[model samples]
Target: SDGTSLEGNVVLPDGKEVDAGEVQEPISDEVYYIAPDKCTECMGFHEEPQCAAVCPVDCCVPDDDHVETEEALLAKQRFMHPE
Candidate 1:
């Protein structure tokens, strides 16, 4: 694996560990995720997005092209947070 993506490490929200890499998908689909659906850009960047703050590798990056309006961000947060 001369040109392989990072693998073999993860910490779950419940503090459990998993050997996901051993049973994961192919490399082409390894480093994969959606912008609007996966991240919110921390709005003002002070309260850093939990995902970005905890990403051990810092692979997370803002998607300017997928910028969401204030209303949109809130809607997303509420959608994910629920009442």
Candidate 2:
């Protein structure tokens, strides 16, 4: 995982140009964002979500807009990464 290609665009929270979909670009002033379709929630990496577990303010709650099952999560992981 040391040199994995993003293969996707890293856009800003307000849809501004940040990384321009490549890692070689210098980071822009725009805040970056990860699309929900690309976010794994750390399912393949950990049992519990490290983000929610280590969040100081406990603001990493589940979103009602984007609900996914365990199977779906795994499938997504595989879909993005065919390795």
Candidate 3:
């Protein structure tokens, strides 16, 4: 595995740019929570979720409670990254 850290541009709902490391809420020292509004499931960026693929423990499964259609996921991705 590459030693590169997972980081990227993050935009809030109010159009504020935030540090990627600060995006996920900390549940504990070893656990973090990804907000649904901030997660696009890598729809427009990859064929599948990279998180799930790269997770050593295979803990990045889909959230059935917040299931979204493909179109909706793409739309969210486009909104977050207009470039």
Go through the candidates in order and give each one's C-alpha lDDT: 0.52, 0.58, 0.66
Q: Report the lDDT tens digits of candidate 1 across residue range 21-63.
A: 5543443666745444434455433476777777899887767
* Candidate 2 residue-wise lDDT, 27-78, digit = tens: 4558443346556777777888767778787777676888888877776666
Deviating ranges (above 4 Å) for candidate 3: 1-28
TM-scores of all candidate predictions against the true structure: 0.44, 0.56, 0.62
lDDT (10s digit) by residue, model 3, range 13-71:
44777665654445578774556775778887898877777889877766689888888
Candidate 1, lDDT over the whole model = 0.52
Ranking of all predicted structures according to TM-score, beginning with the best and ending with the worst: 3, 2, 1
Better of 1 and 3 by lDDT: 3
Tell me how far candidate 3 lies from the true structure as C-alpha RMSD in angstroms.
Answer: 6.0
Top candidate by TM-score? 3
RMSD of each: 11.8, 6.9, 6.0
Point out the higher-scoring one by TM-score: 2 or 3: 3
